[model samples]
Target: MIRPVAVIGAGPYGLSTAAHLRARGIPVRVFGSPMVSWREHMRAGMLLKSTPVASNIDAPQPGHDLIDFCADTGERRYESDWDLVPVEIFARYGQWFADKLLPDLERVRVVSVDRAGAGRDGFELKLDSGEQFTARAVVVATGLSGLARLPRELAAATSDGLSATGPFSHAAQHRDVSRFAGQDVIVIGAGQSALENAVLMAEAGAASVRVVARSRGAVAFGDAPDRQSRLRPESPFGRAWSLYGLTYHATHVRRLPAPARHYLVRRVLGPLGAWWLRDRFTAGRIQVTDGRRVVRARVEDGRPVLTLSGGQGAGRELSADHVMAATGYRMDVAALGFLGHELRTALSVSRGAPRLDAGYGSSVPGLYFTGLAAAASFGPVMRFVCGTEYASPRVARAVEVR
Candidate 1:
């Protein structure tokens, strides 16, 4: 009998995982578009937090590689610098790799996954298209779609008049939001998205753009150094990179205990990239309200009013025409509807993430995870597109069937 395998979530991690398994002579069924959500949802001109080279899915093997595709087409987007890749170029790269590598993929969504047999050795995946698939093993590369987290205050205010998300939607449509010129805009959270959008709104003629951050300020650069610099301490990016390299060079990220890895991740990755967009945040006369949280948001006379509270029980009320939340995301298994009750109950969880082994397989047999969901087990790097190279191969080895 032919072995059956399914790769879920056709993003970089999922596609790459499928490609690697296919290359290893495994029969793979891949679903979803290659970078479809990223291309459609993210704003134009948004630069990636990951370097192009670090973002490759499959390790270079003879005759098949992203670099070769770029070389053939003369697409220089594959050779990006500054550790930031543009979204458009990355999308093209993914499409190119998909066309040349794995082309037989299902574009439908997997709605639910459940045990198919009495032995529970095989699994059944139900698709939104009313089709069902039984596979020996399943890899959920669905990426981070289920985890777009907004602040509780912002989430509550979204029902009110305040438009807390999609500040860039207008900008992405190339509409000049100059009508709001000199208008008040309050941005919640200090992440790169918050700062970047705040800058855009300020540039679009918002009179006063204020950013409320739980951190001290808009992130500053050189905070999380690149991996390359870590290999050599005296390199241009400096000691932070060198330290990072030294830390990961000796031991594989998989070998480290999950808790220790997560702690290291919290220290090294969290709030670090927020610094990269500091220049953009500081570009115009945008205001920074750091070390504060928005306690309440209410509409008054069609204006969004916010009550900000600081650490010492201090409070201030500010009004804005618009509020945007860039508070990042959480990965609770409950958010993933496809996971059946048995799988969800069997899998270990730390915080909101599914606990996985070194190869990114969950505690439940034959059900593996990769990319962001696997970050809790794999380390901070695993949370990024850059880490997919490591994650894809490991997952392929674990779940790929002959």
Candidate 2:
């Protein structure tokens, strides 16, 4: 029997990889709800920082790009990268891509993935619905599951000795911010997610919202390109030549020394907000406590009190009804909790992320990872949708040859 290859996610990377594998005539099974994170975790009315042109889920063949979906669905067709794309629109486009290219994708959750057994060269996946199957290979494309980064201090404060629930939460935990209405919210982080969520909470009627970041300067915004500048098309991320090279030449990035590669991944696309978000973040809407980091947090009278120090000022205290840590994600291979002990033990890792080869394969043969989990090996491009353009076809080719 020809064992099927398993793709364990239905987001951009999973969909893109599945399309490439199928195009190569490789038998594949795909799992997970298409765009589940975008549809559920993201707040309503949020706009994508990425522009229209750079926001496509790469398909092996033509006619499945975001522009194609927009045209086919009669959605507003954006003419350039400067146009801000809405999260809802992007989620819809993903669903359309799945329908057109991978309609057979199974929408079940994978509960566990273990080695088939001694001398077996494949994996056995157990599904949430009590179904089980063995695949010749498994691609773990699960996006940010279990990877949300909560600071040690904030995490300790929020826990009741049992769970990290109540009064504190990660930015990715909310689909709606209105729940914080009339409450004081202390938003931590200076990145787009942190800035955007602070604005969102204030807009949702939060009594007060303040942004705290370790950087002393005000949050920076991406520059709007002049008409002359727009003549040269912008990369999906931005117009920087470095970004274009990073997006296109990811293989070169993988070849660099581990430290250099990791440093480039962290610094290349650092933190900033979209130009469009600036207007909403003015003093009238929100207050920003720049250059401060939360050194400690404790629950006081059913609220979160943060002791912050850094930047130029003396340490200070801020009390808020709730704390929102937009601290971002950390790629830990253990976060892929479905992997069995032996399989995870067999793979090599760097800073908790799987160490991947040129083909995005882990140390274990036939076991692969992509998307955010592949960032350590592939570079920061793996963190964005555009990474699929490089990862999908390359991984498919490797799998086909194997």
Candidate 3:
């Protein structure tokens, strides 16, 4: 019997996991579309958080890389991770790579995963199409679909007429501001998506667009790059960059103390990303309220009204035509509901993530997690495309072939 390796999710990380396993002569079964989240969640004009130089999956051959694809396509290539990428193009690239290498991948959805027994070497997987199978090992690489964290208060008070959910069209869905021609729009959060949403609203001809931030300005840990700055070599101050063999040289990326890494990420990296997006955001014709927090929201007059407060002040209320949030994500283990109680109970998690060994294997034997869910233990880099190259091989070597 061919005890295949089962991979959940067909997003970039899932596809990359499948590709790596296949290269080792492992019979891998993958579920979902390549870059499904990007196709559904991300806006069209939005660019990748990382530049071309920092984005790639682990390819068996040396030249099968993201930069090479960009060079061949005459796309703009930047040396630093600070550069932007159009969401559509990046998603297309993943599709292109997956089609070329892992054509046997299935796009069917995974409904549930269960454990047959403690002594069993494999897992029982149930698919939405009414198919069931056993795998020698199972890897969950579902990416962001499992969770879309929103403020608890916001989630409870809103309905579809005034709710936050995926597949909700952003600015890219409309060609002109005429669709929003007479509505008062409110954008929450100061991340890239929030700025992009604000721009889209203004361009869409919203009667007015109000952007609220918890911070004084959008908090980015790094500074924006000028022409001279963009030409600099890859380093901490320049933004993390990894070339063909350069990633191995950075011991910090692999061995920093958790506290130190967290501090650096909070004080340095997080602010830098916000800085890069600042200019593009300010260029828009919109209203921005700094240092305000949304404490409560309610639907009033068929529109949404928000009560906001400053760090050291009493609350004040504001209303909008519609409120949209780009507040970012949280990698909660409970998000993987498709993994039934049997399998989930067997998994150990710390701070909402599966606690894993350096090899990406979880406490449960023959079960693993990579990509976003793995970042809590591995470091922030694990959340990005760049981290895939390092994590894939560890899982490929640890899991037995079919």
TM-score of each predicted structure versus truth: 0.85, 0.95, 0.84
lDDT of 3 by residue, 1-402 (tens): 988899998877888788888888999999887887888767646666666656676676675577666676786664455666677878777887788788988989888888766777778888989999988888999887746556665665655522232212233222233456678877777766667667766766688888778889764434555532554456423434432223333224336555654443233334324355556555666788879987888877666778888866658888876677666666787878888887777788765778777668887888899887876666666667877777787778878531
* Best candidate according to TM-score: 2
Tens digit of lDDT per residue, candidate 2, span 1-402? 899999999999999999999999999999999999999988887998877777889998899988999899999986585787889999999999999999899999999999897888899999999999899999989998778998888878754631224788888888888888898888888888988998888888999998888877857777765532554545667666777778887888888889987888776666787788888887437888888878888988887889988866657999988889888899888778899999889889988988898999999999999999888888899999988998999999999998
Q: lDDT for every model?
A: 0.68, 0.86, 0.69
Model 1, 35-92: lDDT tens digits are 8867775656577665555556564365435466667788663543455667777788
Residue 224 Cα positional deviation in candidate 1, in Å, after optimal superposition: 11
Poorest stretch of ten by lDDT in candidate 3: 165-174
Worst 10 residues of 2 by lDDT: 157-166
Per-residue lDDT, model 1, residue 62, is 51
Residue 381's C-alpha lDDT in candidate 2? Answer: 91
Instruction: Tell me the spans in candidate 2 whose CA falls farther than 4 Å from its real position.
Output: 161-165, 227-234
